[model samples]
Target: MRGSLTTCVLFCLLSLGLSYPMMKGKPNDTSSKPFPLEDPTHNLTALADRCTDEGFDAMTLDDQGLIHLFRDGYSWSGFRGAAQFINETWNLTVSVDAAFRNHNKNQPQTHQRMYLLQGSDVWGFYEGHLLAGYPRPISQEFPGVPDNVDAAVECHAGECQTDSVIFFKGDTVYIYSPMDVPVVKQRHWAALGPCTAAFRWLERYYCFKGINFTRFDPVSGEVLSTRPLDTRDYFVSCPGRGHGHVARQNATLMSIKNRCSGRPFKAFSSDELGRTYVFRGGWYFRADSSKDGWHAWPLSHSWRNLQGEVDAAFSWENKMYFIQDSQVTIYRSNPAYTPVQGYPKPLQEELGVTEVDAAFICQSSDVLHIIKGNKLRSVDLKQSPRLPGQERPIAHTQVDSAMCNANGIYLFHGPSFYLYKDVEEMVTAAEPPEPGNIAATFLQCTE
Candidate 1:
């Protein structure tokens, strides 16, 4: 069923409050005791006994994409309150002595580690255990950051140019960036008041107040219009909450044929969310850099109307375009995936293409590449009317789907995918690289 790092001196100028352990201290110290190599025997009762319903002490997500909730307890008892956030319910497993921890996926994979903050000491945690020789002094690791701050979280605001670690203490906020000195600022949202804990999930920032939380913009420091929601209802399972797990369904196992066996309806990457959407038949598979792997969801679950299957899909100008039959549907790239009003226009009227076998738009350009049979037409999305450019021949006789990202374009044909360095190579290459199996490459499946 369920399962569950570097130097200090050189990183002094960098952001503190990182989840990754900083430095190795004396091994003789009790605080530096090695964490258990295996998970402590899961005792849900231990958490219930300590549960005052005061909400989580700190929250963070690990590199594996698992959300961790920490509840405070005696470090000496080796019974630190920690639980795994699974399917909107808390599993009273995992235990760690961290007042608060922060994990940033933006860091290089090597540096994408977790660190635990306990008083003035910082420790490194990996997998389910704490690294040996940890418990380093916060002063030596994070020079100016005040220890035992109210809450700490890593957030990347949409309007802001850089990401930062926001430390909340009383009514003050310390914004820490790796490239610059930490900047101190005062809280502006009086409605939410000071935060007890903060977390980043799916690119959204959440500030926790006791058992309640409010969605806030880290860059503007403005609380959202929506009213505060209870963390107990949203983060964990509680009786009469009717907020968590009630709407969540367990993942269904996909049949072998559906896992990656046939031609895909459409495949496109959303740069904003850093996830790829591969649609086929009535189901869509979501792939990302998280350990959650690939899971299929009904098309209507996320995208409303225009269901059954999509002919082609691509993201442009912060909106998602889905082509089906002779019609095109557009949606905003937000959590709701709200459909744009007055959509489902004729494909010819919108993109100047009657039909499309596949479509893609590179990150750097506004040209929308539409493929039908062996012909690929380029349309300048910047220009009015969006007339189609001269049609060109592609290396492939036919493409099942097309997706573009920073790396280049991927042409999916049948069960195989061809990766081209760019649109030029995609259209000019006489012999593309040996096609890779879609199931193995995109779906992370293998025989």
Candidate 2:
């Protein structure tokens, strides 16, 4: 009966907007105060009153397959406007859940993304941590939020009568507080066995493994610490701690003393999100100094829609530079790792160079400098890459292993450093040393 009623209300709302186009109105202001938590649904009926024939079809689905039904004519104002109408009309919890393919079969868990709208706010989650910034903003930065909401799980989104918002992802379900950033209640879920499924009932968050389930204390943030949860409590089948009942594998957190492996970098640069991207083996990987080992990033295809792997990459301003041979491509990512559209521009059109060994964004000038062997070209992207000064040469025994920072450019052969103080002078003035005499001239940084 509830499902039928939900369908009827959904159809009515859809018809109102699809049948008669709404009078174009200003975009809904999202900065207003959220609905009073105490009596959130007390007056949702009033919102249903506003859902008249005068409406616009602001509903659409994203590439991720999540349906977006914006309030009024355009844009997502928040769940309040929609939730209010639905709840007032039916007095039910407003939540959505959708299943997405497990791109990786090894992680063949039924991956899902959850979206929940209480007032005008929406929260998203993925992996284990909060998605920070994603398809859209869900934090205090976007407005209409009063608390910190840190993370969520995979699903359409489930309703929450309590203060927290519950969502699902992978083998686990999570309970998060809604604020600037949502904080997961079971902060220590990692200690438990691999999770297959999770859900929420009343106010508590429950995570299941085939037949095993762990109940987390909402206030204490404890996961099955007090006692185990039984299936009799609810009828559900957990995916089994991962595929083969093996324990879940998580990134090993490393202290500052720990260093990342996979060294001898070809190109390197840090992005706006403070993540340092290093390119090697046609693959771009990031070694979180905060974590041990290097984590491989997205496959080459997503980097720039490129045919081959990116040779080198760096982040400047908000844009990223993807270098391969002499061709240079620019990429911008909002949610980090995810590349924006329209890039892979030919570097030759602007610099007239067809071979680039390495590239870096000069911090002093906030400009791009492409290096081909000993040659240096300053590029001005605003009006095409322009080399205002005479092309300079670099001082390096070899050109392949190179990196630069605010201080200077370093060409390293193992621990030996070939530091170039004035790259322009080093490039134009220095002559090629005797092939065997190179060892005598290279400067090695030593105490």
Candidate 3:
């Protein structure tokens, strides 16, 4: 089956490390040889690509190939905070701050500050005083000011901006500036909070804080949904109280539940089994227990210890694959009840799978892409059993991250990661859209 260009690029780079030329003139096709499973220390070409020096606090792949990276930058109040979309080729970035200063002498400074950026334009929102104790919305939209407005204010012999309190509510952004003239009007807008974890499914934006989940429309800034649960509950009790995982199978707004206690759901793989299994905080769990909800059959008499924390897990062809401590571990049958002999050994030792802190696994056509630690690698399961000992480095980069959709794999590098159409088809072929009455368009929150 054909693979992604990014995958091909990675394979070529790996081939180069093995002294194999991937270009047209190469004599031997050593690329098919299995990677060396014994070598521990391997040489990787220093990443030639220049990445952002400021580093990224968070990164995600957009529908387009562009990478959306949130970076923390310096601010006026000696308080440093994140600036969104600092760099983007496909994804948009916005900045959040609680310390923006307004310089108007007549205005009393408030404490709210937020900045929204789309493409090259920016909208600075502040809630504080503007002139002589009279409260006003301090903004740069006033005429005669430079389109790219950067202002500094002075207060109490110290130079600073006055307006600092500002918050964003979808498209209807709000600013609160305190002034001498107190207007006794209740602001219906919720207080601006910290922007931490974020995820995008269709038009809805998902933000999380531990177990508390909130959904908003990126365009309209309207609050859509909020669930107070960690990653497990976020997927399980998604739609509402009564909604279960069965109804979520083929629906656009589907929900999966943790009907069984102790066992939590892991990554979902679109494969032949159509069986969804849960990992009980470890690599072991009851096998094929889709009916019992728990302890249907112990795959192994003793749980197989991976020797490290599990970072990623998926199943294909009735086999379970997991990444732990940068090493790939595959089990022939579910770990709960399978015999020791049923577990497969590590696929390759030279994949340089270390530093694999996190992962998002998806497929392109028949090729499986493992995205972790800012790099993407393609693994062919069809060929996995054939060369039980061969190993190869798929791809490596310091500038990109990957996400999967039905159409293809989204690669986010530097400012932008574009979508490769073919890769998306394989990943979404068997998977169904998340179930719910997801609004076709997210309405901007004006209230």
Candidate 1, run of 10 with poorest lDDT? 1-10
Question: Which runs in model 2 stand beyond 4 Å of their true positions?
Answer: 1-264, 290-293, 301-304, 307-309, 337-342, 385-388, 406-408, 413-447
* Highest lDDT against the true fold, candidate: 1
C-alpha lDDT of candidate 3 relative to the true structure: 0.29
Each model's TM-score, in the order given?
Answer: 0.66, 0.39, 0.25
Candidate 2 lDDT over residue span 1-447, tens digit each: 000000000100111121001101112221111112232332324433222222212222222322223222122222223333423321224432221111111222323333433333544334322345433434442333333222222212222323443333332435544434545543334454333333332122444443344555433335643444333212211122111111112122111101222134466666654555545455344432211111232234235344354555666667776777666676665543345555556767645656666666655456666666666776665544454345675655355545566446655443334555545544654653323211122211111
Q: Give per-candidate clash totals.
A: 4, 33, 70
lDDT of each: 0.57, 0.37, 0.29
Worst 10 residues of 2 by lDDT: 1-10
Residue 50, model 1, lDDT: 21
lDDT of 1 by residue, 276-342 (tens): 8877766565655334222344566556654667778888877888888899899887645789999
Q: What is the lDDT of residue 433 in candidate 2?
A: 32
> TM-score winner among the candidates?
1
**What's the CA error at residue 250 for candidate 3, in Å?**
37
| TM-score of decoy 3 | 0.25
lDDT of 2: 0.37
